[model samples]
Target: MIVVALRARSSWHKPAWWATAFGAIAVATYGILWATPVVLDGMLGGRNLLTLVRDAAAVAAVWFFHNAVAAQQRKPEKKLPAWGLGLAVLSFTVPFLLISRPGPTSSAFVLDRLDQFPVWLFSSIYIFIVGALAARAIALLSSEKTVMTRFYVLGLSLMLVGSIIELMYLAATHFGPTNPDFRESLYYVAERPFFGGIFITVLGFLWVYAVRVFWKHLARWTLRIDARHEGGEYLARSLATSSENGWSDRQLAVNSAVNIRDRLKIGTQALSRREHALFSGVEHLLSNHLERTPR
Candidate 1:
């Protein structure tokens, strides 16, 4: 007699990434749908509203690792994760300060672009930086032995390159148009290649290398493991929209400190004492409930 055994699902095989991807798409969608209303308009304080969403995505990425993305039996990092998340939440305020207050002096440095581009552009960067840092933390979990590889280092490097571009753009308005020759070269570089240009190109190659090596292992989880379980099969269903609905509450729970995102995504217009207390209360409740759930 031949028999088929239904395998009991492991905790790691759950729909966490699906939820993470969902939240990412929802924000990206919010950004796209409201691009004109929130991103392009600074007259009615829409820019700050957009900043809220950007920061929330950052906080969400941080929380994802904290709550859903970690390995089974693995511990989260203590320091770098905090730093990554802090910068992500803090990055939201950069635009508000640039746009708020009296005169052009509030944007004392090269942050003029805060006024020029929609907040979503920079917010996208903030989210990516947060994700990169979080990925580095995940990679570092195995950094002690031979498994400690180039992926973490590469992620750090990409985050630095993107950060430098952001900082330089803030410092000078002519960053992209520095010189006709440089613009032509860089523009062409960005068009054909993913990262493009000299430094970014180098980092791009490194990112690919890191992705190749690290994802070779991660693909086991992303693909090979999917072959083994129903939940994994669910996760594999959408490359664009993973089970985003799965871990959203988890995202919010870990990022309760990241009020910037909480405000924007939830569209909290003003945080009076009552609203603040309510949000605080809700976050506290969620945190407790999250601690109990298996996901």
Candidate 2:
């Protein structure tokens, strides 16, 4: 993420910038998780606000990822209207705030709060948004033939599948099972694909960025070589033009050989006996033709 951010520092509107944002926000979401909800909840006033923040960050990261993919495909950089985004945020925030979080901050927030309506509401909204964006990304990348696009599609497909599994698990927990162990097992099963998908997606982005940088440097090197050998290149082109303009096959071959020799700075003495003999004969023949040509 830091590398991407540095590379994208020049332009805020490029696809790289959006990709950087996606990476950063995704990292932050997990950073919160790694900090442990107990610590974060206490710092944020103990209403499990960290969970809400984590879910919000996850949604934002996915949204940024969708934008990155769209921009990479050369789509218009249209963002969701501010009002719509605000309303969506409010929808999630209101439910979370209204729900009672009476006990000490639980490490297993999702499993413990599965029975709460607000928890279900928050989870449903997050899953739905993530699923939709992942599906859109898959659809966008399906038409692209690049290796990076294939990786992107595969990653997004995994994410979409994970979202579907999580939704189903949520429903089962509500309607089918009340057992804590069963819910925990189901949660892990559903969570693995999402994290795997994220890993693969970030890898794809970094790989593609590195490839682009390599090609850019290669192009610069070729351009420098072209500039340095301008005279040799011009001579080669002139010889080709003469050959195309009704020069005899013998004349063309001799001229092309001479051009190669001069371009490589090969001296007559450097030629092998047979090669020296052939060039001498061709030069003599060319001289005779030049002498006979009308002045």
Q: Which has the greatest TM-score?
A: 2
Estimated TM-score per prediction?
Answer: 0.35, 0.67
TM-score of model 2 (CA atoms)? 0.67
Off by over 4 Å in 1: 1-27, 30-48, 66-73, 76-91, 94-157, 172-295
- Ten contiguous residues with the weakest lDDT in model 1: 1-10
Question: Any residue pairs clashing in model 2, and if so which?
Answer: none
Q: Write the per-residue lDDT of candidate 1 for residues 131-248, one digit (tens) a residue.
A: 4554554454454432223443444345445445544443333434464455345433322321222234234334443554453333333232223233454435533232355433
Top candidate when judged by lDDT against the true structure: 2
Tens-digit lDDT track for model 2 on 125-154? Answer: 778777887897787778888887888888
C-alpha lDDT of all candidate models, in order? 0.40, 0.65
Off by over 4 Å in 2: 32-42, 77-87, 102-106, 217-295
**Candidate 1 pairs with clashing backbones:** 18-242, 18-243, 18-244, 19-243, 19-244, 22-244, 56-261, 110-170
